[model samples]
Target: MSDIGISTKAMGKSGVTFSPLKVLKGFIPKLDTKAIVKNALISLASILLFVLLWHLGANYLFNIEATAKIEKARTEQGAEAAAQMEACILSGDVSCQPNTLPSPQQVIVAAQNLWADHLSISAKKTAFKAKVATTNADRKAQGLKPIKYTGRPSFIDQILTSIKTVFAGFLLAMFIAIPIGIITGLNENLKTAFNWLIQIFKPVSPVVWLLLVFMIVKTLIRDPELDKSFIIAAISVGLCAMWATLVNTSLGVSSVKTDYMNVAKVLQLSLGKKIFKIIIPSSIPLIFTGLRITVSVAWMVLIAIELLAQSPGLGSFVWEEFQNGANDSNAKIIVAMFVIGIIGFLLDRVMLFVQQSVSFETQ
Candidate 1:
């Protein structure tokens, strides 16, 4: 018999080992990294599949019923259009007509057209700028057509406005929130005073705060010095969303092991040295985490801010898309939606890279 068939007289000192691949699914605990990764990958795939299924279902479900409803609506609208034309011929002024919504296909095409036009215009402007930078005859040489991105409503403009708002607000939030967080974490008295404020503001509804901010900024600030509309919108959004970071940073710093604090004291380190060398390093993980959350919150709140009474960013873009009734507006709407998602994801990844670069490494 082969060695495998023979009874083992003694097990190896290291003991019998089995490959994870040899085990069935669910034969491991939650703490098992191999199993966890495997399961997570599977779950991710499942989620993607579910999302795809949901999209398709949302697009078309129980085909006959959808077709029936669409056909009925189309017929009614066609009849109304004929009546409107008849009335126009008979009467000098024709105002009565059916408020017909565009089909999904029409909306998609419009959205695509908007995206193309936007890219073309953006490219032209870029090329113009480049040529102007290097040569005096750049304008004459650079003969790019003036292709506008949208029709009466400019979705591209709205998106750009939103992006500007997000970046500015996010930066401002970080500036104020981070410093205060550090101060609170470093000093007991400061922490005691600031903790209540953080707690109260953290869960405050973003909409309420934004409305209040809009009122305050618009009423108090002059439009000449600052664009109150956009600036207040951005600031309100940023302020509402950044409390988590402030609180997290303070908590992270406070929770750093007592041993490290003691070591810093023993070394007779200056306050700045203690902060930069000891305290900061210890709380990097938490700070980065908080930053990530804050930025994401800022990004998400952007749409809400824009969609509200006077949203400036992608919110306005989407609003216009919806207002267009899904015909000549769909494609631009889709493109704007994509731009928002891509920008948010990219921004978060950039922050992650920054965190990794600044953070201490452990082998």
Candidate 2:
């Protein structure tokens, strides 16, 4: 009787007790497991099909090159030389292999090689830092600069450099565009005055921007220790990408509802308060949309700017690999190409997520 009474008390007025099984059942109904499995399977199948096609294409190109080499030997030298060429090709000699489109497997191998190279470089950097620790400390005590590692950067380091450059450019774009956009949006005359400038610069090429920035930065920044290439690339990227944000911000601020403006006036809010409390809040969705576009544009133009500026990033890596023309160079290039695409996709997704997070409509 006491046990029954205790159980009833635990159940409370609802006469129900907590059950782990019941909670699990509640969550199970919310999840469509079959659909998730189906989608996963479909994605796997698609990747496999792509790999198979790539393998077939790579083999076809290899055979064509091999046959050409053998035929050339037969025509110029002799049947004996042709047989030797065929034997060399069949022996899995890299010299006889065609340097064309790499198979998916080759790309995978290249990626692994890059990762290994990064690890090796990281180890070297660590050892170098340790070796200089005491010397660096002495230098610091003497008010001198610390010794730094000057080794070549690995593929991973290049990737990090690129990400840093893009973010720097993005921040610059935001800082310059938002204030100008707000000022212009607040006054018709300002908008009219800025319209021509925006229209003229909006269509300018990234290379042109790079050259313009290079000219200005070179004239201004005379410090030899500063990374001029990185500065030029970042500035060029910002200049090329800021127009979308500027235009969108202006449009957003101008499109605020008349009722909100009237309310702000009734409250007798200061210019700053009105902008901060009403204008910005109302314009957030469009502002975020513009920001999203700006980020995408910045990333797209970054490669070109980095290439021209000779910034130690993926752009430089690609250029170097192309010039290398080694047996594995094509594979490495393919690897970089895929990395670029994946990173671009991720950046867009991140921007989209941020936009959705702040916008009520998206929520």
Candidate 3:
């Protein structure tokens, strides 16, 4: 009787002891917050150190002999001229060594100036639009057609143009590559036939592709003002960037499980059903991976293509600024470079997110 009573008491104590502890454990986070904070601080420190190093290196005294004349002029011309010269050197206004490698502060100031210039241009555009509207109303009343603004493209406009060109090329590559890849993957004979062509074209440079595209486009297109450069650039980008997608998609398709094929055969599915339900769904991950690489290649190739094609994009903007060699030219180029890198990173991250969303396996 005593043993039975002890067992009952022990069972009664077990419910209250473990249940609340398990409930409280569920509220705890799996992540190590301290480690995350530590990593963030380390990244911040490294960036700060890099900026500090850049500041030191850019401002270091180089070609002191060349700048001696300016220093002498500063000493003799009194405080006003000396201050002006100093400001000019710091801002890369004077044509010298300092002008070539602009300091971080100078780049920042140049960014500000570029923003201001953009704002100024925007204001002018707004005014021009207002004038155009007034003139168009009058012209419409007189049964005449409206005239659009024909001013130079702004920085933002060039950026948008680049984006459009890249997307156009990327879409073209996808359409060409995915269909061909699927076929090649499904058929060994077709893969063998196309393998040589893929090998030959994959190593060709973007500049070479641009030249080839130009030759073809020039023969076919007679109009320059109707956006011919854009077409050529897009075609060139497509040609250069399509190989990755083609290869990956083929591999992905070929690597599909034999069991899947057996099942499809057992089910006696039609060709379309087999491709859509079995092959394409399984190959999406690799195809997307290829697409990410293709997009990156397209973006990288676009700058060179635009430079060669003289298209009104960031590539042209960089080339124009380099040729112009103004005080702020280097900084503007740097700005464009950073913008390109940032955009590429964002594109990769977006593709990664899509891959994760659709992919079967995740870690």
Candidate 4:
């Protein structure tokens, strides 16, 4: 009995237990299964409701257009033409189908077609790369440019391009806004002087920014190989989006606690140290908030800027589809719309996560 008690105490010290119930508890995680089930069911129901509403709306518009077509045929070409038009529509001929809002099924089909196009494009790119590998190597030896793929970008490629453009714009906004904001925030007179400029530019339209950027980029970027449209779009997006970050950063820095500043002064911290250690740390939450807003604004303006600049991105995709007016064009546009919204939501969430990770208040 004395030896068993000693062994039990030793096991306790080592955090080793030998009970069936305790082992079972350790292996089984505690979870609120009911809550999980309830949330899943609610989400399912919501999605179903949205799909149902979309179906109804699409069907209503489709019927109205179809009825008008039939009526026009009857008025001009008599009962036989009207009957033929009705039969054509009933037979689900693409030519006779109403070019209105597409149902969910049509959107799904569009999405699948886009995916197939992406795959086909990817295969072609791979083949092109393989075919040019030897020629590219010889060109490098001869000091000439290698052959490049000149095919149009697929849907996925456009999405990636748009994402890249937005990120470039966001970086530009951060770099420009933060330094100016800090300088303005540090000096009362500077803030007062710059207030008018900030206020004036903050409400400027994205189209105006794009035009301004286009004029400058066209003059500055004379290289035929350089992507002038991308530069203009990125710069315009940056200019349009930076105001939010600039304003928020200024507010955050100016609003830093006096107590922290006093401590920094008491410690004889240098200007750089004071700004980095005291001001920046205190202003992180608000600065991140501003950054999040800036990202959102950048993404929002990017579409318009891309459209104006003729950048090969979602905006261009949307414009091209609208002009094409194919049977699947509307569905494709809707798919792009959903993709844009989802990406925007994800970007905001990512920013929020980063903000929470870095900010003490959020933590």
lDDT of each: 0.70, 0.91, 0.86, 0.93
TM-score (C-alpha, index-matched) for candidate 4: 0.92
lDDT per residue as tens, model 4, 1-363: 677566667778898966667545655898889999999999999999999999999999999999999999999999999999999999999988879999999999999999999999999999999999999999999999999999989999999999999999999999999888888888899999999999999999999999888888889889999988888888999999999889988998998998998999899999999999999889888888899999999999998888878998999999999999999999999999999999999999999999888888623
What's the residue-level lDDT of 49 in candidate 4? 100
TM-score of each: 0.65, 0.90, 0.83, 0.92
Worst 10 residues of 2 by lDDT: 20-29
Clashes of each: 6, 0, 0, 0
Instruction: State the lDDT at 9 in candidate 3.
Output: 70
Name the better of 3 and 4 by lDDT. 4
Best by lDDT: 4
Runs in model 2 lying further than 4 Å from the true structure: 1-11, 20-29, 71-81
Q: Write one digit per residue (lDDT tens) for candidate 2, span 250-292.
A: 9989999999999999999999999999998888888889989
Lowest lDDT sum, 10 consecutive residues, model 4, at: 18-27
Which scores better on lDDT, 2 or 3?
2
lDDT of 3 by residue, 75-131 (tens): 899768766666666664456434456668878887788778888888888889898
Q: Pairs clashing in candidate 3? A: none
In TM-score terms, candidate 1 sits at 0.65
Per-residue lDDT tens digits of candidate 1, residues 1-363?
Answer: 355323232233346554344343334444878888999999999978865675565455424433554456558777665555555434533242222333344445666777677687777767766655545454346774433233333457666787788888888888888888889998999999987888777888878878889778777886574566687778877797678678878887778888998998899899899898988789888888888888888888888777774655688767866786543454456556667898889889988887777677671
* Per-model C-alpha RMSD: 10.2, 4.3, 7.1, 4.1
